[model samples]
Target chain A: MTADFLLSRYPYVLIAVLFAIGLYGMTVKRNLMKKIIGMTIFQTSIYLFFIQGATKQGATIPVLDPELGPSAELYINPLPQVIVLTAIVVGVAITGVALSLILVLYRRYGTLDEVELLRRMRESA
Target chain B: MTSRFESIFLFVVARAMVPLIQVFAFYVITHGHYSPGGGFQGGVMLAASIILLRISLGEESYDRFPREAGIVIGGFGALAFALLGFASMAFGGNFLEYALAVPGMGAEELRYWGIFFAEVFIGFLVWGALVAIYDALESGGVE
Candidate 1:
Protein backbone atom coordinates (compact mmCIF):
# COMPACT_ATOMS: atom_id res chain seq x y z
CA MET A 1 0.00 0.00 0.00
CA THR A 2 2.85 2.39 0.81
CA ALA A 3 4.57 1.58 -2.47
CA ASP A 4 1.38 2.16 -4.41
CA PHE A 5 0.80 5.48 -2.70
CA LEU A 6 4.38 6.56 -3.42
CA LEU A 7 4.06 5.56 -7.03
CA SER A 8 0.90 7.57 -7.43
CA ARG A 9 2.13 10.64 -5.55
CA TYR A 10 5.86 10.94 -6.32
CA PRO A 11 5.47 13.55 -9.02
CA TYR A 12 3.44 15.84 -6.80
CA VAL A 13 5.95 15.39 -4.00
CA LEU A 14 8.78 16.33 -6.30
CA ILE A 15 6.94 19.43 -7.47
CA ALA A 16 6.29 20.48 -3.90
CA VAL A 17 9.94 20.07 -2.98
CA LEU A 18 11.07 22.05 -5.97
CA PHE A 19 8.62 24.82 -5.19
CA ALA A 20 9.79 24.93 -1.59
CA ILE A 21 13.40 25.23 -2.67
CA GLY A 22 12.58 28.04 -5.08
CA LEU A 23 10.59 29.89 -2.47
CA TYR A 24 13.40 29.52 0.02
CA GLY A 25 15.91 30.86 -2.43
CA MET A 26 13.75 33.80 -3.34
CA THR A 27 12.99 34.79 0.23
CA VAL A 28 16.20 33.91 2.05
CA LYS A 29 18.88 34.89 -0.41
CA ARG A 30 20.17 38.43 -0.18
CA ASN A 31 21.78 38.73 -3.60
CA LEU A 32 19.61 40.08 -6.38
CA MET A 33 21.03 37.63 -8.95
CA LYS A 34 20.28 34.70 -6.70
CA LYS A 35 16.75 35.94 -6.31
CA ILE A 36 16.39 36.04 -10.09
CA ILE A 37 17.66 32.47 -10.29
CA GLY A 38 15.08 31.55 -7.66
CA MET A 39 12.37 33.10 -9.77
CA THR A 40 13.49 30.87 -12.64
CA ILE A 41 13.36 27.83 -10.40
CA PHE A 42 9.87 28.74 -9.28
CA GLN A 43 8.76 29.04 -12.87
CA THR A 44 10.35 25.67 -13.67
CA SER A 45 8.42 23.98 -10.86
CA ILE A 46 5.13 25.23 -12.29
CA TYR A 47 6.09 24.01 -15.74
CA LEU A 48 6.94 20.59 -14.41
CA PHE A 49 3.64 20.41 -12.56
CA PHE A 50 1.69 21.24 -15.69
CA ILE A 51 3.62 18.63 -17.73
CA GLN A 52 3.14 16.00 -15.07
CA GLY A 53 -0.59 16.58 -15.02
CA ALA A 54 -0.78 16.13 -18.77
CA THR A 55 0.80 12.66 -18.78
CA LYS A 56 -1.22 9.42 -18.94
CA GLN A 57 -0.30 5.81 -18.34
CA GLY A 58 -0.86 4.35 -21.81
CA ALA A 59 -1.29 7.38 -24.02
CA THR A 60 1.07 8.21 -26.84
CA ILE A 61 2.33 11.63 -27.86
CA PRO A 62 -0.21 14.10 -29.21
CA VAL A 63 0.74 13.57 -32.81
CA LEU A 64 -1.54 12.43 -35.57
CA ASP A 65 -0.85 8.96 -36.89
CA PRO A 66 -2.79 7.90 -40.00
CA GLU A 67 -2.94 4.31 -38.89
CA LEU A 68 -4.07 5.12 -35.34
CA GLY A 69 -7.26 6.95 -36.36
CA PRO A 70 -8.38 10.20 -34.69
CA SER A 71 -9.33 8.89 -31.28
CA ALA A 72 -8.46 11.49 -28.62
CA GLU A 73 -7.97 8.94 -25.85
CA LEU A 74 -5.04 7.36 -27.63
CA TYR A 75 -2.99 10.53 -27.14
CA ILE A 76 -2.04 12.68 -24.19
CA ASN A 77 -3.73 16.02 -23.68
CA PRO A 78 -2.27 18.58 -26.12
CA LEU A 79 -3.75 21.63 -24.41
CA PRO A 80 -1.30 21.61 -21.53
CA GLN A 81 1.60 21.21 -23.95
CA VAL A 82 0.41 24.22 -25.94
CA ILE A 83 -0.08 26.29 -22.81
CA VAL A 84 3.35 25.32 -21.50
CA LEU A 85 4.97 26.33 -24.77
CA THR A 86 3.59 29.84 -24.40
CA ALA A 87 4.48 29.84 -20.71
CA ILE A 88 8.10 29.05 -21.54
CA VAL A 89 8.32 31.96 -23.96
CA VAL A 90 6.71 34.23 -21.42
CA GLY A 91 9.19 33.00 -18.84
CA VAL A 92 12.08 33.92 -21.08
CA ALA A 93 10.64 37.37 -21.64
CA ILE A 94 10.13 37.87 -17.93
CA THR A 95 13.66 36.77 -17.16
CA GLY A 96 15.08 39.10 -19.76
CA VAL A 97 13.15 42.04 -18.41
CA ALA A 98 14.19 41.20 -14.85
CA LEU A 99 17.82 40.93 -15.84
CA SER A 100 17.66 44.28 -17.58
CA LEU A 101 16.24 45.86 -14.46
CA ILE A 102 19.00 44.28 -12.41
CA LEU A 103 21.53 45.64 -14.86
CA VAL A 104 20.20 49.14 -14.42
CA LEU A 105 20.11 48.76 -10.68
CA TYR A 106 23.65 47.49 -10.56
CA ARG A 107 24.86 50.28 -12.78
CA ARG A 108 23.35 52.97 -10.64
CA TYR A 109 24.05 51.42 -7.24
CA GLY A 110 27.21 49.41 -7.92
CA THR A 111 25.99 46.56 -5.74
CA LEU A 112 23.74 43.55 -6.18
CA ASP A 113 23.27 42.84 -2.50
CA GLU A 114 19.64 43.40 -1.64
CA VAL A 115 20.28 44.99 1.73
CA GLU A 116 22.86 47.35 0.31
CA LEU A 117 20.57 48.33 -2.54
CA LEU A 118 17.71 48.98 -0.20
CA ARG A 119 19.89 51.21 1.95
CA ARG A 120 21.02 53.08 -1.13
CA MET A 121 17.48 53.61 -2.28
CA ARG A 122 16.52 54.94 1.13
CA GLU A 123 19.40 57.35 1.06
CA SER A 124 18.38 58.67 -2.33
CA ALA A 125 14.76 59.01 -1.41
CA MET B 1 32.10 45.98 -28.75
CA THR B 2 33.61 45.98 -32.23
CA SER B 3 36.23 43.37 -31.35
CA ARG B 4 36.27 40.36 -33.70
CA PHE B 5 37.60 36.98 -32.66
CA GLU B 6 40.60 35.72 -34.60
CA SER B 7 39.46 32.11 -34.81
CA ILE B 8 39.13 30.94 -38.41
CA PHE B 9 37.43 27.67 -37.44
CA LEU B 10 34.68 29.33 -35.40
CA PHE B 11 33.93 31.82 -38.16
CA VAL B 12 33.75 29.21 -40.91
CA VAL B 13 31.56 26.75 -38.94
CA ALA B 14 29.17 29.43 -37.72
CA ARG B 15 28.76 30.90 -41.19
CA ALA B 16 27.97 27.49 -42.65
CA MET B 17 25.55 26.53 -39.87
CA VAL B 18 23.48 29.74 -39.82
CA PRO B 19 21.71 29.11 -43.12
CA LEU B 20 20.95 25.51 -42.17
CA ILE B 21 19.41 26.61 -38.88
CA GLN B 22 17.28 29.21 -40.66
CA VAL B 23 16.03 26.65 -43.20
CA PHE B 24 15.05 24.29 -40.40
CA ALA B 25 13.22 27.09 -38.58
CA PHE B 26 11.19 27.86 -41.71
CA TYR B 27 10.39 24.18 -42.08
CA VAL B 28 9.14 24.05 -38.49
CA ILE B 29 6.87 27.03 -39.03
CA THR B 30 5.43 25.96 -42.36
CA HIS B 31 4.88 22.31 -41.39
CA GLY B 32 3.40 23.08 -37.97
CA HIS B 33 -0.03 21.78 -38.96
CA TYR B 34 1.02 18.14 -39.06
CA SER B 35 4.09 18.16 -36.84
CA PRO B 36 5.37 18.80 -33.33
CA GLY B 37 6.93 22.13 -34.27
CA GLY B 38 5.17 25.45 -34.51
CA GLY B 39 5.58 29.24 -34.71
CA PHE B 40 7.01 29.89 -31.22
CA GLN B 41 9.50 27.01 -31.49
CA GLY B 42 10.61 28.04 -34.96
CA GLY B 43 10.91 31.70 -34.02
CA VAL B 44 13.12 30.90 -31.05
CA MET B 45 15.30 28.74 -33.28
CA LEU B 46 15.66 31.56 -35.79
CA ALA B 47 16.60 33.95 -33.01
CA ALA B 48 19.08 31.40 -31.66
CA SER B 49 20.89 31.28 -34.99
CA ILE B 50 21.26 35.05 -35.09
CA ILE B 51 22.43 35.10 -31.49
CA LEU B 52 25.00 32.39 -32.30
CA LEU B 53 26.34 34.62 -35.04
CA ARG B 54 26.48 37.59 -32.70
CA ILE B 55 28.31 35.67 -30.01
CA SER B 56 30.90 34.15 -32.35
CA LEU B 57 31.37 37.01 -34.83
CA GLY B 58 30.92 39.98 -32.45
CA GLU B 59 30.00 43.48 -33.68
CA GLU B 60 29.95 42.50 -37.32
CA SER B 61 26.68 40.68 -36.60
CA TYR B 62 24.96 44.05 -36.08
CA ASP B 63 25.93 45.14 -39.59
CA ARG B 64 23.69 42.45 -41.05
CA PHE B 65 20.74 43.01 -38.71
CA PRO B 66 20.80 46.22 -36.74
CA ARG B 67 19.30 46.47 -33.25
CA GLU B 68 16.88 49.21 -34.28
CA ALA B 69 15.62 47.11 -37.16
CA GLY B 70 14.68 44.34 -34.78
CA ILE B 71 12.43 46.63 -32.73
CA VAL B 72 10.72 47.90 -35.89
CA ILE B 73 10.15 44.36 -37.15
CA GLY B 74 8.73 43.35 -33.80
CA GLY B 75 6.30 46.28 -33.82
CA PHE B 76 5.18 45.51 -37.36
CA GLY B 77 4.52 41.90 -36.51
CA ALA B 78 2.36 42.89 -33.53
CA LEU B 79 0.46 45.35 -35.70
CA ALA B 80 -0.14 42.69 -38.33
CA PHE B 81 -1.60 40.27 -35.77
CA ALA B 82 -3.90 42.89 -34.25
CA LEU B 83 -5.01 44.11 -37.64
CA LEU B 84 -5.89 40.61 -38.74
CA GLY B 85 -8.13 40.20 -35.72
CA PHE B 86 -9.79 43.55 -36.33
CA ALA B 87 -10.26 42.77 -40.00
CA SER B 88 -12.56 39.94 -39.02
CA MET B 89 -14.68 42.45 -37.09
CA ALA B 90 -15.03 44.59 -40.23
CA PHE B 91 -16.78 41.63 -41.91
CA GLY B 92 -19.52 41.72 -39.25
CA GLY B 93 -18.18 38.80 -37.24
CA ASN B 94 -16.54 38.52 -33.87
CA PHE B 95 -12.80 38.90 -33.55
CA LEU B 96 -10.66 36.28 -35.31
CA GLU B 97 -13.63 34.89 -37.24
CA TYR B 98 -11.51 34.10 -40.28
CA ALA B 99 -14.28 32.61 -42.42
CA LEU B 100 -16.27 35.81 -42.36
CA ALA B 101 -13.19 37.91 -42.97
CA VAL B 102 -12.39 36.11 -46.22
CA PRO B 103 -15.72 35.55 -47.98
CA GLY B 104 -16.27 32.78 -50.55
CA MET B 105 -13.61 30.42 -49.09
CA GLY B 106 -14.72 27.25 -47.34
CA ALA B 107 -14.84 27.67 -43.59
CA GLU B 108 -12.22 24.99 -43.01
CA GLU B 109 -9.87 26.45 -45.57
CA LEU B 110 -10.27 29.90 -44.11
CA ARG B 111 -9.47 28.57 -40.65
CA TYR B 112 -6.37 26.85 -42.00
CA TRP B 113 -5.21 30.08 -43.60
CA GLY B 114 -6.04 32.05 -40.48
CA ILE B 115 -3.97 29.79 -38.27
CA PHE B 116 -1.14 29.87 -40.79
CA PHE B 117 -1.05 33.65 -40.99
CA ALA B 118 -1.29 34.00 -37.23
CA GLU B 119 1.61 31.60 -36.81
CA VAL B 120 3.65 33.50 -39.35
CA PHE B 121 3.03 36.78 -37.57
CA ILE B 122 3.80 35.26 -34.18
CA GLY B 123 6.98 33.77 -35.61
CA PHE B 124 8.16 37.17 -36.76
CA LEU B 125 7.14 38.83 -33.51
CA VAL B 126 8.88 36.33 -31.28
CA TRP B 127 12.00 36.32 -33.42
CA GLY B 128 12.35 40.06 -33.46
CA ALA B 129 11.38 40.54 -29.81
CA LEU B 130 13.95 38.02 -28.58
CA VAL B 131 16.66 39.57 -30.70
CA ALA B 132 15.76 43.00 -29.44
CA ILE B 133 15.94 41.81 -25.86
CA TYR B 134 19.36 40.35 -26.53
CA ASP B 135 20.53 43.60 -28.05
CA ALA B 136 19.26 45.59 -25.08
CA LEU B 137 20.95 43.31 -22.59
CA GLU B 138 24.19 43.36 -24.51
CA SER B 139 24.21 47.13 -24.46
CA GLY B 140 24.01 46.96 -20.66
CA GLY B 141 20.66 48.54 -19.87
CA VAL B 142 19.49 51.55 -21.84
CA GLU B 143 21.85 54.35 -22.81
Candidate 2:
Protein backbone atom coordinates (compact mmCIF):
# COMPACT_ATOMS: atom_id res chain seq x y z
CA MET A 1 0.00 0.00 0.00
CA THR A 2 2.78 2.41 0.98
CA ALA A 3 4.68 1.58 -2.23
CA ASP A 4 1.62 2.28 -4.33
CA PHE A 5 1.04 5.53 -2.54
CA LEU A 6 4.60 6.63 -3.16
CA LEU A 7 4.41 5.61 -6.77
CA SER A 8 1.29 7.64 -7.30
CA ARG A 9 2.88 10.72 -5.78
CA TYR A 10 6.28 10.25 -7.35
CA PRO A 11 6.09 13.22 -9.68
CA TYR A 12 5.33 15.64 -6.87
CA VAL A 13 8.00 14.14 -4.67
CA LEU A 14 10.52 14.35 -7.46
CA ILE A 15 9.63 17.96 -8.09
CA ALA A 16 10.04 18.86 -4.45
CA VAL A 17 13.39 17.10 -4.16
CA LEU A 18 14.67 18.56 -7.40
CA PHE A 19 13.62 22.01 -6.32
CA ALA A 20 15.30 21.64 -2.96
CA ILE A 21 18.53 20.46 -4.50
CA GLY A 22 18.48 23.20 -7.09
CA LEU A 23 17.86 25.84 -4.46
CA TYR A 24 20.59 24.42 -2.25
CA GLY A 25 23.12 24.44 -5.03
CA MET A 26 22.12 27.90 -6.17
CA THR A 27 22.62 29.17 -2.67
CA VAL A 28 25.72 27.20 -1.67
CA LYS A 29 27.71 26.96 -4.85
CA ARG A 30 30.35 29.54 -5.64
CA ASN A 31 31.09 28.50 -9.18
CA LEU A 32 29.14 30.22 -11.92
CA MET A 33 28.75 26.95 -13.78
CA LYS A 34 27.40 25.30 -10.67
CA LYS A 35 24.89 28.08 -10.23
CA ILE A 36 23.87 27.79 -13.84
CA ILE A 37 23.47 24.07 -13.33
CA GLY A 38 21.28 24.81 -10.33
CA MET A 39 19.20 27.17 -12.39
CA THR A 40 18.78 24.48 -15.05
CA ILE A 41 17.64 22.03 -12.42
CA PHE A 42 15.14 24.55 -11.11
CA GLN A 43 13.76 25.18 -14.58
CA THR A 44 13.58 21.44 -15.24
CA SER A 45 11.38 21.00 -12.19
CA ILE A 46 8.91 23.44 -13.71
CA TYR A 47 8.83 21.39 -16.88
CA LEU A 48 8.12 18.35 -14.76
CA PHE A 49 5.33 20.24 -13.06
CA PHE A 50 3.62 21.05 -16.37
CA ILE A 51 4.03 17.51 -17.64
CA GLN A 52 2.69 15.96 -14.46
CA GLY A 53 -0.29 18.25 -14.38
CA ALA A 54 -1.17 17.39 -17.96
CA THR A 55 -0.84 13.60 -17.54
CA LYS A 56 -3.86 11.34 -17.84
CA GLN A 57 -4.36 7.64 -17.45
CA GLY A 58 -3.61 5.71 -20.68
CA ALA A 59 -3.24 8.93 -22.60
CA THR A 60 -1.66 9.05 -26.01
CA ILE A 61 -0.41 11.90 -28.14
CA PRO A 62 -2.87 14.69 -28.88
CA VAL A 63 -2.77 14.05 -32.58
CA LEU A 64 -6.02 13.28 -34.31
CA ASP A 65 -7.05 10.48 -36.67
CA PRO A 66 -10.37 9.91 -38.37
CA GLU A 67 -10.13 6.14 -37.79
CA LEU A 68 -9.74 6.66 -34.07
CA GLY A 69 -13.20 7.65 -32.97
CA PRO A 70 -13.83 10.36 -30.37
CA SER A 71 -13.70 7.66 -27.71
CA ALA A 72 -9.97 7.25 -27.33
CA GLU A 73 -8.46 5.69 -24.23
CA LEU A 74 -7.18 9.05 -23.12
CA TYR A 75 -5.49 12.15 -24.37
CA ILE A 76 -2.77 13.95 -22.48
CA ASN A 77 -3.18 17.68 -22.45
CA PRO A 78 -1.37 19.14 -25.42
CA LEU A 79 -1.32 22.51 -23.70
CA PRO A 80 1.28 21.36 -21.23
CA GLN A 81 3.44 19.80 -23.87
CA VAL A 82 3.36 23.00 -25.83
CA ILE A 83 4.11 25.03 -22.73
CA VAL A 84 7.00 22.78 -21.80
CA LEU A 85 8.51 23.18 -25.20
CA THR A 86 8.60 26.91 -24.68
CA ALA A 87 10.10 26.45 -21.25
CA ILE A 88 12.81 24.19 -22.61
CA VAL A 89 13.74 26.71 -25.24
CA VAL A 90 13.85 29.46 -22.65
CA GLY A 91 16.02 27.32 -20.41
CA VAL A 92 18.47 26.57 -23.18
CA ALA A 93 18.64 30.18 -24.25
CA ILE A 94 19.30 31.31 -20.70
CA THR A 95 21.97 28.67 -20.27
CA GLY A 96 23.72 29.62 -23.47
CA VAL A 97 23.58 33.31 -22.62
CA ALA A 98 24.83 32.58 -19.12
CA LEU A 99 27.74 30.52 -20.44
CA SER A 100 28.78 33.20 -22.84
CA LEU A 101 28.56 35.75 -20.08
CA ILE A 102 30.74 33.48 -17.96
CA LEU A 103 33.24 33.31 -20.78
CA VAL A 104 33.39 37.06 -20.88
CA LEU A 105 33.67 37.16 -17.10
CA TYR A 106 36.53 34.73 -17.20
CA ARG A 107 38.22 36.77 -19.86
CA ARG A 108 37.96 39.89 -17.74
CA TYR A 109 38.60 38.40 -14.30
CA GLY A 110 40.64 35.32 -15.10
CA THR A 111 38.54 33.20 -12.77
CA LEU A 112 35.24 31.34 -12.81
CA ASP A 113 34.64 31.42 -9.10
CA GLU A 114 31.80 33.81 -8.45
CA VAL A 115 33.06 35.03 -5.09
CA GLU A 116 36.60 35.65 -6.27
CA LEU A 117 35.36 37.39 -9.38
CA LEU A 118 33.07 39.56 -7.31
CA ARG A 119 35.92 40.42 -4.99
CA ARG A 120 38.19 41.47 -7.84
CA MET A 121 35.45 43.43 -9.49
CA ARG A 122 34.76 45.26 -6.26
CA GLU A 123 38.41 45.94 -5.69
CA SER A 124 38.74 47.35 -9.16
CA ALA A 125 35.63 49.41 -8.73
CA MET B 1 33.49 16.83 -24.98
CA THR B 2 33.00 13.81 -27.20
CA SER B 3 35.14 12.45 -30.03
CA ARG B 4 36.09 14.69 -32.93
CA PHE B 5 33.92 12.78 -35.35
CA GLU B 6 30.87 13.01 -33.14
CA SER B 7 31.43 16.67 -32.46
CA ILE B 8 31.89 17.38 -36.16
CA PHE B 9 28.78 15.42 -37.02
CA LEU B 10 26.70 17.25 -34.42
CA PHE B 11 27.96 20.57 -35.64
CA VAL B 12 27.25 19.71 -39.23
CA VAL B 13 23.76 18.50 -38.38
CA ALA B 14 22.99 21.56 -36.31
CA ARG B 15 24.27 23.83 -39.06
CA ALA B 16 22.12 22.06 -41.59
CA MET B 17 19.00 22.41 -39.39
CA VAL B 18 19.19 26.11 -38.61
CA PRO B 19 17.02 27.13 -41.54
CA LEU B 20 14.70 24.23 -40.99
CA ILE B 21 14.28 25.07 -37.34
CA GLN B 22 13.59 28.68 -38.25
CA VAL B 23 10.90 27.68 -40.68
CA PHE B 24 9.36 25.38 -38.11
CA ALA B 25 9.39 28.20 -35.59
CA PHE B 26 7.47 30.45 -37.96
CA TYR B 27 4.96 27.74 -38.70
CA VAL B 28 4.42 27.14 -35.00
CA ILE B 29 3.95 30.82 -34.31
CA THR B 30 1.50 31.29 -37.15
CA HIS B 31 -0.51 28.14 -36.66
CA GLY B 32 -0.21 27.84 -32.92
CA HIS B 33 -3.93 27.74 -32.14
CA TYR B 34 -4.42 24.69 -34.33
CA SER B 35 -1.57 22.82 -32.71
CA PRO B 36 0.35 22.65 -29.46
CA GLY B 37 2.27 25.86 -30.03
CA GLY B 38 1.85 29.63 -29.88
CA GLY B 39 3.74 32.87 -29.94
CA PHE B 40 5.86 31.98 -26.96
CA GLN B 41 6.99 28.73 -28.56
CA GLY B 42 7.61 30.45 -31.85
CA GLY B 43 9.52 33.25 -30.18
CA VAL B 44 11.74 30.82 -28.39
CA MET B 45 12.26 29.01 -31.64
CA LEU B 46 13.29 32.27 -33.26
CA ALA B 47 15.67 33.01 -30.45
CA ALA B 48 16.96 29.48 -30.69
CA SER B 49 17.61 30.07 -34.35
CA ILE B 50 19.68 33.11 -33.55
CA ILE B 51 21.40 31.23 -30.78
CA LEU B 52 22.10 28.41 -33.18
CA LEU B 53 23.67 30.91 -35.48
CA ARG B 54 25.77 32.13 -32.61
CA ILE B 55 26.89 28.62 -31.73
CA SER B 56 27.62 27.69 -35.31
CA LEU B 57 29.17 30.96 -36.36
CA GLY B 58 30.39 32.49 -33.08
CA GLU B 59 30.04 36.05 -31.77
CA GLU B 60 31.34 37.52 -35.00
CA SER B 61 28.23 36.24 -36.78
CA TYR B 62 25.86 37.95 -34.32
CA ASP B 63 26.94 41.31 -35.65
CA ARG B 64 24.16 40.96 -38.18
CA PHE B 65 21.83 42.36 -35.51
CA PRO B 66 23.33 45.16 -33.55
CA ARG B 67 22.91 45.28 -29.78
CA GLU B 68 20.85 48.45 -30.17
CA ALA B 69 18.48 46.68 -32.52
CA GLY B 70 17.96 43.89 -30.03
CA ILE B 71 16.95 46.40 -27.40
CA VAL B 72 14.58 47.96 -29.87
CA ILE B 73 13.12 44.57 -30.66
CA GLY B 74 12.44 44.02 -26.99
CA GLY B 75 10.59 47.34 -26.82
CA PHE B 76 8.76 46.53 -29.99
CA GLY B 77 7.42 43.32 -28.47
CA ALA B 78 6.02 45.09 -25.41
CA LEU B 79 4.56 47.79 -27.57
CA ALA B 80 3.01 45.28 -29.89
CA PHE B 81 1.38 43.34 -27.07
CA ALA B 82 0.00 46.50 -25.50
CA LEU B 83 -1.19 47.88 -28.79
CA LEU B 84 -2.96 44.64 -29.51
CA GLY B 85 -4.77 44.76 -26.20
CA PHE B 86 -5.57 48.43 -26.56
CA ALA B 87 -6.74 48.07 -30.10
CA SER B 88 -9.35 45.68 -28.82
CA MET B 89 -10.57 48.44 -26.50
CA ALA B 90 -10.64 50.85 -29.41
CA PHE B 91 -12.91 48.40 -31.15
CA GLY B 92 -15.39 48.64 -28.23
CA GLY B 93 -14.14 45.86 -25.97
CA ASN B 94 -12.13 45.39 -22.83
CA PHE B 95 -8.38 45.15 -23.00
CA LEU B 96 -7.14 41.97 -24.66
CA GLU B 97 -10.70 40.86 -25.30
CA TYR B 98 -10.26 39.83 -28.90
CA ALA B 99 -13.84 38.66 -29.38
CA LEU B 100 -15.19 42.18 -29.86
CA ALA B 101 -12.11 43.55 -31.62
CA VAL B 102 -13.03 42.40 -35.08
CA PRO B 103 -16.70 41.56 -35.28
CA GLY B 104 -16.36 40.65 -38.93
CA MET B 105 -13.89 37.86 -38.19
CA GLY B 106 -14.80 34.76 -36.26
CA ALA B 107 -14.08 35.04 -32.55
CA GLU B 108 -11.74 32.08 -32.59
CA GLU B 109 -9.82 33.44 -35.53
CA LEU B 110 -9.53 36.81 -33.87
CA ARG B 111 -8.20 35.23 -30.71
CA TYR B 112 -5.72 33.24 -32.72
CA TRP B 113 -4.52 36.28 -34.58
CA GLY B 114 -4.20 38.30 -31.41
CA ILE B 115 -2.18 35.60 -29.75
CA PHE B 116 -0.02 35.15 -32.83
CA PHE B 117 0.79 38.82 -33.11
CA ALA B 118 1.44 38.99 -29.41
CA GLU B 119 3.73 36.05 -29.71
CA VAL B 120 5.70 37.80 -32.38
CA PHE B 121 6.24 40.68 -30.01
CA ILE B 122 7.11 38.32 -27.21
CA GLY B 123 9.61 36.56 -29.39
CA PHE B 124 11.28 39.79 -30.30
CA LEU B 125 11.22 40.96 -26.70
CA VAL B 126 12.64 37.74 -25.34
CA TRP B 127 15.38 37.61 -27.95
CA GLY B 128 16.35 41.22 -27.39
CA ALA B 129 16.21 40.91 -23.62
CA LEU B 130 18.46 37.90 -23.74
CA VAL B 131 20.96 39.67 -25.92
CA ALA B 132 20.88 42.73 -23.68
CA ILE B 133 21.38 40.69 -20.56
CA TYR B 134 24.29 38.93 -22.16
CA ASP B 135 25.72 42.21 -23.30
CA ALA B 136 25.36 43.68 -19.86
CA LEU B 137 26.91 40.67 -18.19
CA GLU B 138 29.81 40.76 -20.56
CA SER B 139 30.43 44.46 -20.16
CA GLY B 140 30.16 44.30 -16.38
CA GLY B 141 30.51 41.47 -13.93
CA VAL B 142 27.36 40.50 -12.01
CA GLU B 143 28.64 41.18 -8.53
Top-scoring candidate (DockQ): 1
Candidate 1 per-residue lDDT, tens place, B1-143, comes to 43568899989999999999999999998889889888899989989998888888898988888878777877887999999888878878778877454557888998899889888888888898899999899887654
Which stretches in model 2 have alpha-carbon errors above 4 Å? A60-125, B1-16, B59-63, B99-103, B131-143
DockQ by candidate, in order: 0.74, 0.25
Which candidate wins on lDDT? 1
Give a tens-digit lDDT track for model 1, residues A1-125. 98898788999888889999899989999998999899999999999999989988788989988899889888999998999999999899999999999999998889999999999999989
What's model 2's lDDT at A49?
88
Candidate 2 per-residue lDDT over residues A1-125, each given as its tens digit: 99998898998999999999999878899998899999999988889988889878887778664567556466667788877876786687678677877877887889988779989999989
lDDT of 2 at A4: 94
Compute the lDDT of residue A109 as modeled in candidate 1. Answer: 86
Q: What is the TM-score of each candidate against the true structure?
A: 0.94, 0.70
**What is candidate 1's CAPRI-style docking category based on DockQ?**
medium
- Which docking band does candidate 2 fall into? acceptable
